[model samples]
Structure formats: C-alpha cells, structure tokens
Target: MFYTYILASQRNGTLYTGSTDDLAKRVFEHKEKARAGFTAKYGVDKLVWFEAFEERENAFRRERRIKEWRRAWKLRLIEETNTDWRDLYDDLNNLLSY
Candidate 1:
C-alpha cells in the first residue's frame, strides 16, 4: 500500500504533508528527525492524519492535492478524524505488528 500522511508539531501547530510506500518507517524518520529538513526544523513529528491508497500514483496525487490546500482546510481535515489531535503513530505501529 501507499500512503498520504500529515504530521504536526502539536495541536494547531506546524503541519507537513507527505506520501510514501512505507508509512511507518517514513513517519518514524520524521519523529526521530532522521534528516534535517522542514519537518525536523519545525518539529512536526506527530502523525495526525493519513490515508492509504492501493496505487502509488493515487497516494502521490492525494498528497500533492493536500499540499495545495489552505491551512484551514487541512486543519479541518485533521479535526474531522482526529478531534483531539492525537498522535496516530503508535496505533499505526501496533497495527503493523500484527
């Protein structure tokens, strides 16, 4: 599966959107600050929202579209699924472990 995901520094804080085939590993990299980039610099490491696609192209396309969305739109998207802005990384890892 491919994934489009959003990470935030905290509730109503900095946000980032990305797509990857390995969602868990990619989010882990961000959380650990594995690379010095926007996410690392801005401390956006919490997985607030994500969507999976059966095709890589679809995931990438979704990510690009989300990247163009206004901040309010993105925030609304997150809040729709995650009203408390909880970190979803742990749940993702747990699911993958099974």
Candidate 2:
C-alpha cells in the first residue's frame, strides 16, 4: 500500500505533504531526523493526517494536491481529523506487534 501524508510543526505551523509506500517507516524516519531535507530543517515531524492509496500514482497525486492547498485549508483538513494536533507517532507505534 502507498500513502499520502501530512506532517506539521504545530497546529497552524509549517506543513509538509509527501507520498511513500511505507507510512509508518517514513514517518518514523522523519521523526528521527534520518533524512536531511525540508522536514528535518523545519522540525515538521508530527503526523497530522494521512490517507492510504492502493496505487503509487494516486498517492502522489493526492500528495501534490495537498501541497498546492493553502495553509488554512491544510490546517482545516488536519483539524477535521486531528482536533488536538497530537503526535500520532505513538498511535502508529502501538500498531506494531512488538
């Protein structure tokens, strides 16, 4: 499965949109600052929202669309799903079977 995800620094702070095949792993990498890029530079590691796609093309398309959206729109989207703007990494980590 592929995924389109959004990472945010804070409730109305910086936003990043990207597509990846491994949602959990990608998000983990971002949090760990494993990759050097915009995410690491801006400290945008909180997984605000994400959508899974059956195809990579669809995931990419969705990611591009989200990237083009205004900051207000993106924040609204995140707020709709994650009202508290909490770090979703723990939730994803719990999904693992140890």
Candidate 3:
C-alpha cells in the first residue's frame, strides 16, 4: 500500500506531510532521525495522521495537496481524527500484528 502521512513535533508544533509505499519503515526512520533534514531538525517525528492508498501516485498527490494547505486546515485535519495528537505509529504496529 501507499500512504499519505503527517508527522508533527508536538501538539500545535511543526508539521510535515509525506508519501511512502512502506509506511512503517518510513515512520520508523523519522522516529530514529535517520537522516539530517527538516524532520530531524525540528523533531517532527510523531505520526499523527495518515491515509492509505492503493496507488503511489494517489498518495503522492494527496501529500502534495496537504502540504499546500494552511496550517489551520492541517491542524483541523489532525484534530478531526487525532484530537490528542498522539503518536499513531504504535497503533499501526499493533494493527499489523493482528
């Protein structure tokens, strides 16, 4: 599956939108600060929102659109699904285990 995901530093903090085919690995890399970049610099490694797609192109397009949105809109999108802004990577792992 392909995915459109949002990572956040903290509640109301820095946010990033990205697309990947391997959601778990990508999020794990972010959490590990695998490379020097925006996510590493700002500690934006919390998986707060995500959507799965069958096609990578679809995920990429959604990610791009999300990135272009206003901060308030993005915050609202996260709050709509993740009111607590919790790290969803753990939950994803659990889901995969089932």
Candidate 4:
C-alpha cells in the first residue's frame, strides 16, 4: 500500500505532507532525524495523520493536494481526523506488529 501522511512538530505546529510506500519507515526516519532537511531543521517529526491508498498515484495526488491547501484548511483536515493531534508514530508498532 501507499500512504499520504502529515507530520507536525506539535498540535498546529510545523507541518509536513508527503507520500510514501512505507509510512512506518518514513515516520521513523523523520522522528530519528535520519535526514537533514525540513523535518529535522524545523523539528516537525510527529506523525499526526495518514491515509492508506491502494495505489501510489492516488497517494501522491492526495499528498500534493494537501500540500497545496492553506494552513487553516490543513489544520481543519487534521483536527477533523485527529482532534487530539496525537503522535501517531507511537501507535505504529501496534499497527505493524513488528
């Protein structure tokens, strides 16, 4: 599966939107600051939201759309799905069972 995900530094904080074939691995890398870029520099590594897709194309498209949205719109999207804005990364282990 593919996924479109959002990572935030905190509730309504620095936000990032991206698509990946492996959500768990990508979020883990961000949390670890494995690469030197926006996520690391801005400390936006808390997985806040994600949606799975059957195809990569759809995931990428959704990611692009989300990225283009205004900050308020994006915040609403996140709040609608994750009202508490929890760090979804903490739940990844249970989701993956690995």
Candidate 5:
C-alpha cells in the first residue's frame, strides 16, 4: 500500500504534503525530526489527514496535486475529515499493530 498524507504543526498551522509506501515510518520520522528538511525545519509533524492507495503512482500523484493546492483548499480538505486537526500517527500505528 501507498499513502498520501498531510502533516500540520498544529490546527491551522504550517502544513506538509507527502507520499510514502510506509506511512507509519515516514510520519514517525517527521515527528522525530529525523531528517533536515522542510517538515523538520517548519515543525510540521502532526498527521492531520491521509489517504491510502493501492498504487504508488496514485499516492504520489495525489501528493503532488495537494502540494499545488492553495492553503485554504488544503485546510478545507483536512477539515473535511479531521475537523479538529487531531494527530493520526498513533491511530495509524495501532491499526498496523493489529
């Protein structure tokens, strides 16, 4: 499986759009600031929204598209499913553990 995910510094804060085959590990890295990049520098480590895809291309495409979207559009997209902008990383890990 692949995933397109959005990470936010906080509710209505800095946001990041990315795609990865391993969603849990990638998000964990962002949270831990494991790499020196936009996510770590901007402190955008809260998993606010995500979508899974059977194909890596699809996930990558969705991530690219979302990255091009306006901030308002991105915020709306996140709010659509995560109105309160809760961190979803823990939930993702729980699901994987099961």
Candidate 6:
C-alpha cells in the first residue's frame, strides 16, 4: 500500500504533504528528525491527516493535489475528519498491534 499524508506544525502553522509506500516508517522517520528536508526544517512532524491508496500513482497524484491546495482548504480537509488535529502516529501505532 501507498499513502498520501499531511503533517503540520500547529493548527495554523506550516503544512507538509508527501506520499510514501511505508506510511508508518516514513512518519516515524519524520518524528525522529531522521530526514533533512522540509518536515524536519519546519518542525512539521504532527501527522494531521492521511489517506491510503492501492497504487503509487494514485498516492502521488493525491499528494500533488494536496500540495497545490490553499492552506484553508487543507485545514478544512483535516477538520472534517480530525477536528483536534491529533497526532495520528499514536493511533496508527495502536492499530498495528492488533
């Protein structure tokens, strides 16, 4: 599986969008500051939102679409599902144990 994900610094701060095949590992790397890029530099490690895709092309396209959206649009998207903008990493971790 592949995933398109959004990370945020805060409710109204910077946002980072990307796609990866290993969503859990990618998010973990970001949380650990393992990669030197936008997420690490901007401190956008909070996994605010994500969607899985069956194909790499679909994930990439969704990520690109999100990247081009306005901040308000992105906020609305997250708010729709995650009004609190909770760190989804913890939720994912719990789900994996089952």
Assess every candidate by TM-score: 0.94, 0.90, 0.94, 0.93, 0.93, 0.92
Off by over 4 Å in 5: 94-98
Across 3-98, the per-residue lDDT of candidate 1 in tens digits comes to 999999999999999999999999999989999999999999999999888899999999999999999999999999999999999899775554
Q: Write the per-residue lDDT of candidate 3 for residues 2-97, one digit (tens) a residue.
A: 899999999999999999999999999999999899999999999999988889999999999998999999999999999999999989977554
The model with the greater lDDT, 2 or 6, is: 6
Scored against the true structure, residue 14 in model 4 reaches a CA lDDT of 91
In candidate 6 the C-alpha lDDT for residue 57 amounts to 100
> lDDT value for candidate 2?
0.88
Query: Which portions of model 2 miss their true places by more than 4 Å?
Result: 93-98
Q: Model 1: clashing residue pairs?
A: none
lDDT of each: 0.95, 0.88, 0.94, 0.91, 0.93, 0.90
- Give the per-residue Cα lDDT of candidate 3 at 68: 92
The clash numbers for all candidates, in the given order, read 0, 0, 0, 0, 0, 0
Question: Residue-wise lDDT of candidate 5 within 57-89, one digit each (tens)?
Answer: 999999999999999999999999989888988
Please provide the root mean square deviation of candidate 5 (C-alpha atoms, Å): 1.6
Candidate 6, lDDT over the whole model: 0.90
Q: Model 3 reaches what TM-score against the true structure?
A: 0.94
The all-Cα superposition gives candidate 3 an RMSD in Å to the true structure of 1.4
Q: Write the per-residue lDDT of candidate 6 for residues 1-98, one digit (tens) a residue.
A: 88999999988788999999998999999999998998889899999898888899999999999889988999999999999988889889675444
Give the alpha carbon lDDT tens digit for every residue of 29-53 in model 2.
Answer: 9999999999999999999888877
Worst 10 residues of 2 by lDDT: 89-98
